[model samples]
Target: MMGQFDKNALPVAIIGGGPVGLAAAAHLIKKGEKFIVLEAGESVGSSILEWGHVQMFSPWQYNIDQAAKELLENAGWTSPDEEALPTGRELVEKYLLPLSNLPEIKEQIMLQAKVVRVAKKAHDKLKTGKRDTVPFQLYVEANGDTTVIEAKAVIDSSGTWTNPNPMLSNGIWTNAERQLHNEIHYGIPNVVQLENRYQNKTTLVIGSGHSAINALLGLATLQQKYSDTKIYWVLRKKQIHEVYGGQENDGLAARGELGIRIQQLVESGRINILTPFHINGVYPTNDKITVVGELNGEEFTIGDIDEMVVSTGFRPDTSFLNEVRINLDSTVESIDTLAPLIDPNTLLG
Candidate 1:
């Protein structure tokens, strides 16, 4: 249920209920400040819930925050004891939920409320020249109705963990084919669908990141059971070992093993490893997909691919903040740290 606000009750409004936003709420609560957190999804940690099946590389110690840890420990919340990394679901249910259930934090969050617009309130004409407190108007839609909230400051921790960048390819591929191939299904937690589709046929995986490695490994696992399937890993670099940089020794080892396995597949002629090349476009050829590319100044085409997995990374979601007067970095899609400076007291950008 939506609660009635007195318009001047809360000094700050937070958009998003992820870890960063929740941590900000904890800080605000500790300082005895009134604030509200608006979450567009059914619960906090909506992105975590979406990737529930995928295990995070970071351990609990790295993932949980000091504020959350203190709150949960004080409440006698038992943390998961598994030495192995926790899946997204486990992190949400065990960490986020427990932290959000704290009395101080729970009351501050409003779930399923989407913030559509944020605008600065116009000061009176006479008061324009004077230094006055700037009010932020937040337009929110919740439960089929529109609501407005005004706050002295706003913090946006709505990162791009929820939005993923689609595969960047030449425009030769049809929209239907892209959807069917799952090329646009960026940041999908599982690769079973792609594995199944490429069964008994050649699959081309492009990229040098962990995503590409994971997809290739999954496809190789499937090929071991299914006799007719084949895999080809294509990278712009000269070798696969260039992408195996991970902080954890085990992580590095696991990635190295995948690289070695790919090499072994190439040696055994089970999988083809194409290096120093880039895909130009995808053309439909009757029932198969043909990938055309360039290698060492010579143009080549790899045909009869049943599926293609592109592991291109994502950029942050900052388009909505363009009109908010927050300075952004020119080279990268991120908020500028120095300009349109954040207030140390309010932490508002």
Candidate 2:
């Protein structure tokens, strides 16, 4: 069911059916442009659903895209409470799901379709001849079948949830760590739902970002119910306060409250804090995990009896864009020019 689009003109290709991808579609529709959305997941916002139990710090007012809001409003969709914060599940259910079901957007989205490669239509990366005239070619796989789709333009909104950073400080993925797949968990696990796995168990949480804080906080809650639950917090920063952000001074009250809450938990001494710890390796021994690292210029080894949560954050998977000749920064792994603008170090400096 093609919209009022020219049959001869190639449609714009939008990758990832998450909020950013869908928002791009909404804007394209407003411009009377043809587009197709290719999502690798089974449904829209599939990555967000992984941490569905966790609440977002931002209110509904900032979460909704203006173009998407216009489209949904025109379709008779009722807006959620503007000032209220929503969980990841609520964002997907109340907002993303509704936007994806719109007639104009629904017909264009392809789910469970992974994009393996993207390149110029008739030219390789090295070939400059007629490159400007050629449309982009995408190799997408779905249901064990590979197909080529051509588009006038491509918008890569495929976020970083699928590609997480390694636990090792050097950013290396070792077999020893890979072998403990069952014991190690990445991102935030729903502690309440998976109580059996974490209850009365020793858990190590690595990293100092919001994701790690959220993971620790969840375990802390679980620890209250089962007094034996042990939690270890590891950070590369010399001072744990470095990760607390602006606290009360922050513009967003909800976000600032996270810093306040985590600080209080630290003061309570429920969690064992390891600062300036650089993990060198992880080993599984006797059905338990052992983490070897350097803590404050001294060798340290922490042997655990249970689960491990690595909240080291995520990176964008840009392998499919290899042949597209896009420039990215090695440090930030983002568009070279834009990396400096968004880099935290730069912003703080």
Best by lDDT: 2
State the lDDT of candidate 1 residue by residue for 116-139, as single tens digits.
877666533334432145567788
The C-alpha local distance difference test score for the whole of candidate 2 amounts to: 0.92
Question: Highest TM-score, which number?
Answer: 2
Name every residue pair that clashes in candidate 1.
none
How do all models score by TM-score?
A: 0.77, 0.96
RMSD of each predicted structure: 6.7, 3.3
Separately for all candidates shown, the number of backbone clashes (residues 3 or more apart, or on different chains) is 0, 0
Candidate 1 residue 90 C-alpha distance from true site, Å:
1.4
